[model samples]
Target: MSEEPPYVVSPTADSSSTARPATFIFLHGYGDDAEGLPLGLAQQFQFNNKMQYLKWVLPNAPHNHEAMARAWYVPKALPNAVKPRVPGHEGEEDAPDDEVGIMQSVDMLDQLVEQEIKNGTPSERIVVGGFSQGCAVSLVWGLTGRLKHQVAGVLCLSGYMPLQTRIQQLRNERGIKDDDKDPKRWFYVHGTMDMLVPTRLFVQGKDELAKWVDKENIEEHLYQGMGHSTNSAELRDMLAFFEKVIPE
Candidate 1:
């Protein structure tokens, strides 16, 4: 129905607020909510003990009729009969951009980062990440949020960026600098056989990311034979990325 408070994990779920040294706000794929990503992660890896000091914030996408489920925004090309498309190939990529809801979602997620700051963690210690649809929103927010420069890193897992044609225009409107030498770290992971965000879009997303981010600051990996979802190897890479960006 409505967006609720995020699912939070502070230190050990019982630690004090002051114990938080870094934060990771991860978003879920379409149809998933605050509960999904963590459950999925737990099934894949046991990083909670190692990442105990990092505060975790998982937000849910609001429900909407157009999405037919929870989603960051409604895709312009709605799915046909049988099953709802999960925003991959099909006509979703080439359709005229539906950006109204995208911008709104960006703003909401930015507020979540701001609230973390108000709670004592600096933006430099914050890492925003997501799966599928959530990854798209996280990347957009990192690039366009008013506090963009202050944030630490972005984690994109098997996702593609939307508004590719309009990103530069949006940046110009927001007065974002064309070249900021000290860009935040970014990790991008996608499956080679991913039809959801197919290879064409994946390459396109990387090229788009290169425009704003330094090539050296971005880490990319393409898993062989993997599909739309993640694997144990991907989870290992995630843990390593977490260590690199949010080190203790």
Candidate 2:
């Protein structure tokens, strides 16, 4: 069978001639197309015009399971029926190839960001973010691997690290000290009641991640009563966080 083409959502600014100051690349969760959550945020923020200075690109994940549904990779089925390892959860069987795919996504994103920069977007103004499975990939790529290009920050919503053991491997391979204080660059957002991924995973990941980086570099926000989805409050807080990290 021929390979399915990748997808990207391009929301342009009011003024087409001027280059945006930065770009935000959104990676969607499993079974979700690039048009959902990211598009919601792009509209909410009116990022195309309000932040006319910023360019928003939402890239759809590859089609899997013949549904044209998006996913970073084929997920490993889970043991507990209540906690199915379908799309969002990070289970052990998901280690090997998922890790590789996450890195590949980062590289691909880096290239896209570089192209934007060459077109007039600045490196320090770029941001990467996503929800659920998308968030998991963003977290792993932001923390473990080195970007060929630097971004302003990363936003990981309702997601957790996939492979915990790879922390040391990532550090050893990339030569990044656990305590290195460059700047607070990673943001973790989750609903306290999100049963899909569970808030506990974030706690666990953070505890382990602390061994390699300053806790300050990672900012966490818990939304009470929210589930595996994003609410208005979450979006507002996310926009606030973005302002702090990528101020014009």
Candidate 3:
């Protein structure tokens, strides 16, 4: 199979012809392509002369069971008899155990990160983020150190962390402490009404992550009525998060 190509979103033409010093990579949700979002997000981003140094990369997911759709991992089948009380909240209860597919996606992302570093950006200046399934993989990369690089930050939107039990096991085995003193900043934005991943995941995630990272380093926001999608408020907050976390 041919490797999937990623979409790139750059600063305005008048901004600069110079190379960017930092890179932001956002993975698309399942069933979506890479084109629309990167550009949309770029447009919504705080655009300024200083922002010209930022570059956005969005990669497409691999083809999955859905007709003409792409997914990062092969989701386990869920019985149709069970339904979520709210729409779009299905599959929130499954274990994060798609090791084969998840590992493959992680490898691909790691290569992308390495390429970005080789191209000019340093590991510390690169941020990896995603929505939903993308968020899951990004979470793995950020928390598990699977990227083999310490990223500047991780942005997780309306998503849940997979392999929860494994993570807990590792923490127990390694004596890793979860505290409010982690130096790296991680931004998590979720909707309270999100049925897809559920709000409990975010709450549980924050608490569990705090055990490994500094409690202060973790920043989370819950939108009141939002669903399994992004909104203007989140974009505005994201821009601010970028400004605070991404170096000039």
Candidate 4:
């Protein structure tokens, strides 16, 4: 229903450098548009000198007429059941089951990566990141893009693993060996008070990921009194993570 561009780009701060720049692709949460928060942050925010070499791409999710929202994929119609449900937290959203639609969005993200590659950044220099629904899409794509290249890092903000139920099948389809580990570095940051994805879901996703990814390769940060949204401290830590993985 709304009209926004397909994507927004924030050029690197140090454009004077001739060497290939790193690219950080960001996807927005459900019902949100990239032209708003993501793009504005990308254009204005800088953590440290390490960010100077990072170019940003924030893409808008395709509109969903059924939900009347801009969503990466439609949320599951029914919430999932939790065993031994917590006393006050029995209700949680178990989303990211839309394989077909998630993959389609991955394909779309792949195009952005391909373009970045053509422009100069290699696959290893690219990072995939997102918030909430965007985070879910990025996770599935980072693991199963058709290009078959492991990206440098993934930034997950207040989100859970979408295809948690089908992770094994996804691994089999991608020819991933049980003992094989990926080159991608994962950084997961969540609010302890988050209600949307819930801390339990984060634990579930983290456990599932540890089966395939080494514990050393993943970093997690939990913020108290925070909700589904991000705050200054989380952003600072994220910048620190980027500095470690991809230096300017």
Top model number, TM-score: 1
Q: Model 4: how large is the Cα RMSD against the reference? A: 5.0
User: Taking the tens digit of each residue's C-alpha lDDT, what string does model 3 give over 1-248?
Assistant: 11667777764535455544788888877666676555566666635444666888888887865324577875543333223232343454453467667767877888888888898888888889888778888777666544533678898888777776677554454454444133457888899777667787777777766666666778899998998888878977887887787745
Once fitted onto the true fold, the runs of candidate 2 whose alpha carbons sit more than 4 angstroms away are 1-20, 47-50, 65-68, 77-97, 174-181
lDDT per model vs. reference:
0.77, 0.68, 0.70, 0.73
Candidate 2: pairs in clash: 178-212, 178-213
Best by lDDT: 1
Candidate 1 clash pair list = 88-196
Alpha carbon lDDT at 25, candidate 4 = 86
RMSD (Å) per prediction: 3.6, 4.2, 4.7, 5.0
In model 4, pairs of residues that clash are none
Model 1 deviation from the true structure expressed as Cα RMSD, one decimal place:
3.6
* Per-residue accuracy of model 2 over 49-114 as CA lDDT, tens digit each: 546455677777776653235677555432232344444544644335356666666666666666
**Candidate 2 TM-score over all chains jointly:** 0.80
Give the TM-score comparing model 1 with the true structure, all chains together. Answer: 0.87
Per-prediction TM-score to the true structure, in the order listed: 0.87, 0.80, 0.80, 0.84
What are the per-residue Cα lDDT tens digits for candidate 4 across 1-248? 12454564645465477645788888998788888767765755653343776778888887876445788876553243222232332333443466887877877878877887897888888888899888888777766665535578888888777786786787688786666657778898789887667787777777876776778988988899888888889878888887777766
